[model samples]
Every structure is written in C-alpha cells, then in structure tokens.
Target: MTLEKKQPTPTAKPTADDEIDLIALAKTLWDGRRKIMFYLLAGAILGLVFALASPKEYTANTTMIPQTGSSVASKLGGLSSLASLAGVNMSNVGDKESLPPTIYPQIIQSIPFQVELMNTPFKCPDVDQPVSLYDYYIDYKKAGVLENVKKYTLGLPGLLLGVLKGEQEEGALLDSTLASSLISLTEDQDKVVKILNEQISLEINDKEGYISLSSRFNDALLAAQVTRKTQSMLQDYISRYKLDKANEQLKFIEARYAEKKAEFELIQNELAIFRDRNKYITTATASTQLEQLQTQYNLAYTIYSDWAKQLEQAQVQVKENTPFLTIIEPVRVPLEKSKPNRPLILIIWIFLGGIIGTGTVFGQELYNSVKERWSE
Candidate 1:
C-alpha cells in the first residue's frame, strides 16, 4: 500500500519582526554581559588612551580694521590716477592700498614665501619644550609613539612603517629619523588662509582689507612675534612694489617739467629781445616779423603753463594718492590655548566608538544566527 507520505508542515516562516527577536537579543547580550563589558571597557580604554596621546593645539586670533585717517584720499587718488592713466581700472581704488590689503596675502602665503620662511627662524612652543617655529611645524607632522600604537590597534597604521613596525613595535619607534615636514597652506571660498597642524591653527581674517592674522601656538611670545613679522613682511612687499610705479612717474614728470620750463624761458627771452631791438624800426616788414615772433612766444608760453599745471597736479597726486596702509590694531600675544576641547572631543569619540562597537557586536551575532540556520 503506497501510503501518502504526510507532507511535514512547513516551519512557520519567520516574519521580519520575528527574525530578529528583540527579547532573545536582549537575553543573549545580557547572558554574555561579561563579553559586552569587555568590549565597553576596551572602548573606554581606547578613548582614554587616545585622549592622552593626542597633542594639545593652541590658536591665536587678532582683528584688523581699516585705519581711518587723513592719508586715505591722497593714497586712493594716486592709485586711481596712475591706474587710470595706464588704462587699468582698479576695483578698490577708493579703499585700502591694493598691495597691502589685497594682493599682499596671496604673495605672502605662496609657496615661494613659505620656502623663504623655511630659511628664516620662527619660534614656537613645544609640548613642554621650546622649538623654532619651523622646527615646531616639522615636529608636529610626525606621528607620536602613542598615536602610532593607537593607529595600529585600529588597523590603519600607515604604509612603509606599518610593514616595518607591525604590532610588535607599535609605540616603541621614534619618528625623528624621517625627513623634516612642512606646514600646508590652504585658502577657502571666503579667501581666509589657513596654516594648520594638529597642535596649532592659524586663521587669517582678511575681510577688512587689514588681515586679522590669527595663529595657534604654545608660546605667547612666539605667537606675538609671528604676528608682528607677518605684518612687517606684508608692509615690505607693498613698500617695494606699490611705491615704485608712483615714484617713477613723479621723476619723469619732474624732468619733463624742468625741460619744458627751460625752453619756455628761452623763447620768452628771444621774443623780448626781438621787441626791444625792432620796436622803433617801423618798417612794414619789421611789424610783420614782430607780430610773428609774438605769436610763437604766446604759443610757447601757453604750452609751458599747461606743463606747469600738470606738474603741480602730478606732485599733488603722488603725495595724496599713494595707497597707504597702516596697522589698525596689532596682534597681541594670546593668553589661552585654542585647542584640546576635552568634553567635546570626548563626546565625539564616545559616540563614534559606541557606533563601531554596536556594529561589531550585532554583525557577529547576525552571522552566527545565519550560519546556524543554514546548517540545520
């Protein structure tokens, strides 16, 4: 007798909610509370270790306002006049000197400028040590031993060294053997220049035509010195270039005026002599010659007068119209460090760590459940 094989009732398909039983998950995690605690403890330790290993950063800030004074009109006019004559329309002619407040920052923060700074001495405060600012930046680029250890622990140790150090020498190796590093300069959409590192931040406020040059460094004295030197460099740039064209123009006008005056005087003297000699000699021919001489003298005198007026205007314009720059408020030494916001950083780190930990725990549990079901 072919007995109809009773089809086994298909196991009730697990619904979406039933697949991940919240009550079961809570029980599983709670039953493995020790394992969970181990993970939490490890995360907390990582946070604490990272917090200690991280370098403290400092920031220095200063505001610059356009200086208000008597020189504005003259400087602005001079720049405009020169540009206008040259067929160049300067956008900020009525405002600050173009070189100082406008073009100077671009020049100063350029690669060549940074290379120049590299050759010069700059002072910066170290983590309980003192260093030249150049060296400070170089050192800041290095991965600290503790930082290396953490990175290795996180499975993201950098190339070259990770293969060399591996897990064995995580925090033991020194970074002094590496080549000296340089600070990177970047500009934002708002045109603010940033020279940054983990330990220091320099934010340049270039909005008011006066650069509010701010920097973060450990040393107050060094911060002040940097700010002052930056300003000086900016001035040096302007003094070298902006005044050159104006001075050249003035010199040219002065020479031309002198030459024109000399010629005018000579023509006047010639006309006077002709009149003195020919006044009483009343021939029709002499009268005609006198009239002709007078006409030439008048023309020469008019030309000379126009030249004289131009010279006066040129001189006034040079004196008044030179785009001048003056520091409104000089940067002061910063008293407080700008970085190492402990609470904020800790909160962020905790949140990130929690997410990673939770993901790992759940991912492992899901994989185990799927494997068991498939095996059955």
Candidate 2:
C-alpha cells in the first residue's frame, strides 16, 4: 500500500561542461594578440604606401540652365488644326522636339561625344603645354614607383593578358564633325575612351532645368579647360539639333525668294517695254496686250512680295528655335585636389586590417578545436 505513494525523481540540470566560457575565449584571443598586432601593422603599412602612391586629381565643375524656346507654341498655333487634319498631333510638339535636361548626362557619356571630347585640346599647367586628353594620358601622366609595383603585383594577371593580346595600332584621331558619324573605334581609341568616361561626370536636375558638368584631371587647368569645352560642345550640339528643321525651312524660303524676285523683275521689265513700244497707240489689240502684260507683272510682284515676307519669317523662326545654354556657374580651375584623402584612406586600411587579423585568430582556434576532436 505504501509503494503506491512513491514520487518520481527530477533529472539533474546540464553541467557547465556543455556551456561556452567567455573567459577562456578571451584568454585564447589574448594569446594571439601578438599575431593580430603584426597583421594589423602590416596592413597599415600597405595602406600608407598606397595612399602615398595614389595620383592627385583636381575637379572642375560648371552649371548650365537650359533656355528652351518659349514662343514655339504660339508660332505653331496657326498650323495646329492643319496638322491635326493631316493626322499629325501638334499638341505639346515643341516640348517633344526639345530634349529634356535628364538626357544631358546620357549625351555627354555617349561614345561619339566622349571621342570628340578626348580630341579636344586642353592646356595643362603641370606639363607646360597644350595637349589632347589622349596625348596627356599616354605621355604626361607619369606613374610613381609604388604604382609600378602595384601594376606588376596586383595587376599582373591583366598585364599578362594584355601582352598576350599584343599591341594594337593607333587609329586616326577623329574631329568633332567626323566623330558624329563614327560607329566604331580602334583599340587605342577605345582605351582612351574608357579613361575619358571615368574622368567626366554629368549631373542633371530636371525640375530646375539645370545640368552640372565636371571633369577630373591631374592638372587643375586642364580639368577646368576640358569641362568648359565639354559644356560648350553640348550647348552647340543641342542648339543645332533643335534648330535643324527651322534652318532647312529658312534655306528653302531663301531659294524660293530668289527665284520669285527674278521672275517679278522680268515681268516688270516686259510690261515697261510693252508700254514704251505702244505709246500713243489707241488700237484695241495693243491695249489688250499691254493690259495682259500689266496684269502678269502685278501677279508676279504680289507673289514675290509674299515670298520675301516668308523668307524673313523663316529667318526669325530659326533664331527663335535656337536653344541657349545659360551658364549658371562657369568652370574654374580648382585650387585644391579633389581626391586622394590620405587620412580617410589610412583609416579604412586600418579597419580592414583589424578585420583580417580577427578572422585569422578565430580560424586558428577553429582548426585547433577540429584537430583535438579528431584525436579523441
């Protein structure tokens, strides 16, 4: 009867052997302190070398506000209905023809644009000469000893691949006018283009209708000059594109005006000769002939006058459609370098080194633990 009342015993809690010991982990890290310090010191030294070896870059920036044709809508108002009848929508057509500020950056970064920019002449104060970007990159940009070491060490694989590919012949430099139609590039030109792309930057603010163009180079003066040139080129290109239709219309009008003027003059001269020849003649036939010549001259003169007015209007339209780039902030030579922040670079290196060292320590501990378990 008493055995029925017996109680079940509780299992004992797991002992400390199954739990982690923070103290022991700390001791292990302490034992590896020297190794960590050595690794960290090595990393810091490497960072210092890299920071010192890095080339200095100066940046030049310019801001431009795009002035679109304001009177375009009014100018096309009379033709709006005609356009609609012809199945062409004229609503907001002016806005459509004018490029948005957002596209400015893309245009600058385009291959043809970059190619033309590379060939643009820039005066470099450091080199004491005016040179194209291609020439400047190849001939004037001297690498430091540390940079040479990195090229052979860190960039060894790329160097070997380039060597295997063999050297490529330089292509003829393209002019702005010719470069617009270029579809391809030579190996040397491609290399220069890649570098040019990296050096140039464009920022567009559509809401404000402004664009900021910047160029970075080792020489301050060159950076400013290149940025200025790029801005000018972009303005010219956009203006030409916007006014292209207007210009063609103007040319046609001028030609027609010339033709009409000659016809009007000839008709007037024929009428005058008829009057002079028929002076004091009262015959019905002579009067009819003179009247017909006079009527022809009047028609020709009216047509010529209309064409002359049209020619003047076309000229005005071309001028009105021409886009203007208002320079909000002009490019200026930078007095200070834009890149190579030595202190920041050094700090980044130190932090990376610490991480590597910590990882190494934990990896060693893990290896030791696995080995001990295997022995057991």
Candidate 3:
C-alpha cells in the first residue's frame, strides 16, 4: 500500500465577521453628526453671547513681604519663663509657641480686618458709578438679590404675611432694609471724610510672606484712594495697640513727678519755718542748717525734674504713634481689568459641551440598540 502523506485539512480564510464592526460605528457617528454639530454650534453661540454680555473686570494686586520681627515674636520671646512654669521641654513649647507664616494670612482675612476695611475707604471700582462701595456689594441699583427675595416672599400668600405680622418680622425687615440702603448710600460720606469702605480685598501668600491688597470702583481715583486709606488704617490699628503702653509709661512718670513736687513744696515750707523761727541773721549754726535744707530741696528738685522729662518723652512718643511697619510696595491704581477671562471661559465651556454632547450621543445609541432588539 503506497499511501501518500495525507494533506492537512484545509482551514477556511477568516471572514470580516471575526473583526470589530468599525464601519457600523462610523455609520452610526455619520448619522448623528448633524445633531452633534448643531449642539456644538449652539454651545459656541451661547459662549459668544456670554462673552459679549459679561462685564469687564480689572484686577490690581499689591504684594508685601511680612516683616521678619513681629509682635508674635516679642510675645513668644521669653519661652524659657513659660517652660519653667509649665514644667515642659523648652524646645517643644518654644517650637509650638512660634507663630507660623499661615497665621498672618489668617489675620489678613480675619473679621477684624474686614471690619476695619468696612470702617475705612476701600471702594469697588467695578460697579460704583455714583453708588458707594457698600451699595455696589449689595447690588442696590436694580432689583438686587435681597430685594428680589423680598418681592418673591411678598408675592406669596396669607401664611407668610401672617408669620411676618406674628413675629414682628415686618418691622425688623424694614429696619434691616433701611439700614442696608443707608449703608449703601452713606458709605462714601462717613469715612471719618468721603470714601466708601466696603470693597477692599486682602490676599496673603504665606509661603512667600507676601500680602496683596486690592479694590474696585468706577472711578480710578476712588480705587486709588481706597488703597492708600487701607494702609493708613493698618497703621492706625498698630498705633492703637501700643497706645496703652505709652499711656502706662506716662502715668508712672506723672505720678512720681507729682509726689516729688509735693515733697519739694513741703521742704520749702519747712525752710520758711526755720527762717521765721530763727532770730539771728548771720549765725554759723543757722547757716549750716539752711545749707542742709537747701541740699534736701535740691535732691527733691532733681528727682522732680527727671520725672517731668520722662513724662514729656512718653507723651511725645504716644502722640507720634509710630510702630515701624515697612511697606514693601505701595498700592497703585490698576489700569487694566482682571476678571472675565474670555479665553479661559471659552475653553471651559467648550470642554463641558464636548463631554455633554458625547454623553448624549452614547446614550442615544444605547437606547436605539435596546429599542431595535425589542422590536426584533
């Protein structure tokens, strides 16, 4: 039996079915392309519309490096004393007590600083045409959010009105609204002169030990005024803190001076008595006693003079109110607007639109697939 080697069974060539259905996917996309394009065009149009309608905003930033030595340093200086009292490790306590750079930033953003700004002349240049900074913040010109809220509530029926009357809410609301309006109106005039005090921004970079102050208004001059006034306000705050120390020193000196003056007056009286009692005008013993009295008087007079000088110095220093804060850079009026970044806004809108459009396309495709299978 001459059997030729059996040929291996022939395998069939793979059909396109074994591969991914890329053409079907392409067709699906092609069918949905009009809808996708429409949505993209709509998004672009809306973005353009917003860009046109948005108000132009300008930003002015001033940077300041914090001083190396501050009040906190002085407060934490005598750590050894605290450590001894607490019976803890001086190093740990001292380290713990040391004020970090972050604290200054927090101070910059604190309510005290905000209240101080409120009392000063920090105007917002963005919105104040004739309105004050406070008014601009509250959006008082045309149906502000608060006004809208009130109008909406008032439009609602009986229950709200009853509640308002029952709680004496109407009076409180009127007072609040009136106060708000007054704050908006008079913010410019009540500056302790004439500048609004509600539009200062304090931005602190703790890592860099820098602070940036900013303000806004319709008038460039007003913005500049606010910036300068804020610095002055900070100076005043520092002065107030040291005012007590100056007063204390003054009081101490004054009290001692008064005592010395009284003693000197008594010595004078004693000298006069001695003169009156003694009949002899040229007695050696009398002369010697007079010299002793003169010496005592001179000593008292010297003490009084020293105390007077100290009191004078304290008063002068107190009046000066200098705390030695260094201004790294002064604030200047910003020429350019800093808000409503058009390119950034466009990018964000485009990105969000693309995501939404893609998701919509996928969702529709899934729904169509399920529907076709159900019909089949």
Q: Which candidate is the best by lDDT?
A: 2
List model 1 lDDT by residue over 1-376, tens digit each. Answer: 8999898655655654576687778876676566556666676776776676666654555555433333232533444444344344545323433343455456666665554444456555444554444555555446566657766676564555657865443223335444235343322211122343222223345553445665555456776766666656655556555456445556755775686678768878988898888769769998888888787677666656655665676576556643244556667776676656666666666666666666677778889889999999
TM agreement with the true structure for every prediction: 0.58, 0.71, 0.54
Best-to-worst lDDT order: 2, 3, 1
Q: In candidate 1, which residue ranges exceed 4 Å CA deviation?
A: 1-37, 66-97, 115-210, 255-325
Report RMSD for candidate 1.
11.0
Ten-residue region with minimum lDDT total, candidate 2? 11-20
Worst 10 residues of 3 by lDDT: 92-101
State the lDDT at 292 in candidate 1: 80
- Model 3 clash tally, residue pairs: 11
Every candidate's CA RMSD: 11.0, 7.8, 11.2
The residue pairs in collision within model 2 are none
Worst 10 residues of 1 by lDDT: 185-194
TM-score of 2: 0.71
lDDT of 2: 0.77
Candidate 2 lDDT, 1-376, residue by residue in tens: 5668666554332334334466667877898898889888988998898898888899999988887654444554455454354344546445434666777778888887888888877776566767888777778777677768888999999999989987655434666678777676776678788888889989878787778889998778888888889988898778877688567656755776787788879988898888888788789999889888887777677667766666677688776744478898989989999989999888889888888888899899999999999999
Q: What C-alpha lDDT, on a 0 to 100 scale, does residue 312 get in candidate 1?
A: 74
